[model samples]
Target: MLNTKKLLALTLTLLFVFALIPAAAQAAPVYRTLDEIKADGTINIGVFSDKNPFGYVDENGEYQGYDVYFAERIGKDLGVKINYVSTEAANRVEYLETGKVDIILANFTVTPERAEKVDFALPYMNVALGVVSPDSRVITDLSELSADDPVIVISGTTAETYLIANNPEVKLQKYDTYANAKNALENGNGVAWANDNTEVIAFALQNAGYTVGIPSLGSQDTIAPAVSKGNDTLLQWLNDEIVSLADEQFFHKDYEATLAETYGLDYEDSLVVEGGAVNAK
Candidate 1:
């Protein structure tokens, strides 16, 4: 019913449109790299806004914590401005994956499951699981805790997972951050608070009425700076920086300066990371 010349022209147009579709679909979205951050004169770092002794804002509304100290140094070394993004334990990885932060300096533990999602540099700190209870009535053994007694832990943390997988009967009262869980424990909301041993030890030492019963749980692991997956350039830069710090025992100095007063005993060798440290071994 159509003219031959007109049908031929329409067919050619359809073919041309189909060819352009593949080209458009094949176009890749531009992703900024670590080098781009340096060129832009600003590096955004993600940190926990409420997690104390690690990352928090002081009375003056200025960020201050062990992690903040490290972030400042990274910015200084890079000769760029530092922008802080307040994050939570659960959101740290999402921040990196979405390019919301160039690096996550928050207290992110290295795990096999998480390693698949992001790249981790050499460890700057070491940690294990621990449980905390009131000094007046501390729990020394896993069997000591009552089946009815609810244990407070941050949701999605290793603490919750460890108890769920290992101790089936233990009741868990999960919160989202250290501050909330600390408050719950202070109010006698739970029988105990379980988390990274480093946090529990610090809390017990700083607050007079609390004590850490389980000093170590599970395997020893390291905390490292994390970047988005496939971000080898940024990961390499962080690794190099960490290695350089190891050579001078920078984290040792960091612990003495920031955490020593919180942890009464001399724990330099236990908590600090020395030069030539590697986790792959």
Candidate 2:
């Protein structure tokens, strides 16, 4: 019912809008597999940039941590150049689902709900929730925390989920990164920071005047590599890699190389996961 020029203009506007749709949105979903990834000769791996001892960048600007060490070995065995992608805990699943990275080695904990989203390859480390607070007044009990004196937890971590699910009344001050949460804890933002026991223990070890009062707060779990869902070829390769590495006592070597300084010989036997199982090295 419009004039020729107006009708033409309206049709062109519609065409332009359609053309502006992102190619990714318009095309069928593309899932990357092992062969396709290998053909590219570079594997993108996601790891935390701020979490220390487990995954972090050193002063020399080189990424160094237990998970990063394991990721380096995967690149070597696969004969591919490794591309390190710095990821946050909250974005670990997103990075895999969107193909931003081929593998997540950022100390990803295996949980049934998370398993539904990404395929966990094999466990390389064992972890459980622990709380750290100022040595002056350690927080050993969760009931001690109130709304005004809450606990700090990293968003998208098992600690947050566990607390929210099991203890709905527990108040939480959630942060996106470990560094931020650590700073908050130091600045008296919360009574304590609840995180992986290894991380908290490392923190207490590295810094004075802080201690892990609650060394083991939640259920024990395993840390493993995660690939995009339905990535069977990649998952199988990773599982095989885990077994092959175990035959060499590689996880023990990994602990010696990365985790030893923080935990020492005392925890060496209790924390390492060998051959995809929770076995002390």
Candidate 3:
């Protein structure tokens, strides 16, 4: 009933529609599975290059820190080499979503909001907010701050989110990197710096003339590794890896090797979470 030319046109339209189906399916973000990563012989990990005692680069240009130590162990266990990718606090999610890095170990805190975007492994560390300011005029309380006195916070961090949600009246000076936030505090760009208690405590210990006026703020939280959303294979592997490492007391060893020099032995029990058991003795 159809002319030859009409039939030809209809066939071409069907082919065009079918061609778009595969292209559309491929357009979604792709993540490597555990088997695929093993096949690749190298797993890319995202970490901060400036956050010391957690994730940073040494003068020798080698990546070194608590997170880096864990990353190294992951690589060794997976029988793969590691490719470290420097990531900032704000870009951690993007790195995972785009497959730029297979895992994020940059002191990433587990939050319900982040959980929606990335799959978080079991916790490896505990954390809370703290404020550090010059000893000359310590800010012991957020209420002590004047409306004009800005608090320094790193963008995309829980500190920023907490302050914004809890104390919207307080002014904030947001920086993109830990180094810049530290510089701003040193240069008196803000009245105080708000960040993870571990970091502010480390700062107060390492540098002179600064004190953590409020040593603990907000609810206690846990830090964990994160992978792309729906990457259940890697997520399960990381969870199992963490649990297996507990038998050997791996996280405690990690803290002693990297953080004890900064926080001393007093904090080891409080900060380190062994085998993903947050409340384990």
Candidate 4:
């Protein structure tokens, strides 16, 4: 129906667009796990960079801590280079969900709420709530805190939940991270700091005038690695790794190597998890 030149031009245009249709269809999906890692050749790991003796940067600008040690091992096992992503407590899940990190070894505590969003691997460490106050005036009992005085807690932590549900009389001054909560209590911003027993004990021992009271509060909880939701492949792999590591009592070894100097002998049993259970070293 057209002249030779016009008909040829129209046919070529149609062929060109048709060619692009197949190319577009052949392109892979954006959020693929295996292909993404294969392309990057590195497994990104998320960890806390401020919470010392667990995950922190040292003097040499190297990420050094208990979690870092494990992250290195994971990278080795995965046959991929380790790309460390420094993250906060609140940002850990976000990092995983956003694909910023393949795994989280950030001392993340396993909870039912978090599990709904992300899959938690088998626990490698045990933890519970504890309170730390000035040595001169320890708060052993919740009743000791005045109605006017608020406790310091890191937001999005078990500490905040525990205090809100259990101690309605006590007000809370919430910070976003462990470093801020520790600093606030150190500066006498609050009468006491409530958080993980391991953190509280470590803080008390690190600073001179503070001591941990109520060394254990609530049921024992396990801290574990977490991966994005629906990531059954990664989740299963992590759980298997945890189980294998537990058989060797690797977590106890991790505790002695990384945490013992900070906490001393008294906390060995309270903080370590071995063979799918909390054990004394």
lDDT (CA) per prediction: 0.82, 0.88, 0.94, 0.81
Record all residue pairs in model 3 with backbone atoms less than 3 Å apart, i.e. clashing. none
Order the candidates by lDDT, highest first — what do you get? 3, 2, 1, 4
Ranking by TM-score: 3, 2, 1, 4
| Model 1 spans with C-alpha error above 4 angstroms | 1-31, 276-281
Expressed as tens digits, the lDDT of each residue in 1-281 for candidate 2 is 46988999999999998887776455443457899889999999999988778789999999999999999999999899989999998999988878789999998989998998788998988889999999888988888776788889999999998899987888899999888998999898888898888889988998899999999987888899999888899999999999888889999999999989889978987898889877542
C-alpha TM-score for every candidate: 0.84, 0.88, 0.89, 0.83
Error of 2 at 230 (Å): 0.3
RMSDs, each prediction? 10.0, 6.2, 9.0, 11.9
Worst 10 residues of 3 by lDDT: 21-30
C-alpha lDDT of candidate 4 relative to the true structure: 0.81
Poorest lDDT segment (10 consecutive residues) of candidate 4? 27-36
> Candidate 1 at 193: error in angstroms?
0.4
Which candidate do you rate higher for TM-score, 1 or 3?
3
lDDT per residue for candidate 3 within 12-54, as digits (tens), equals 9999999998885566667999999999999999999988888
Total backbone collisions for each predicted model: 0, 0, 0, 0
Kindly report which residue stretches of model 2 are placed more than 4 angstroms away from their true locations once superposed: 1-29
lDDT of 2: 0.88
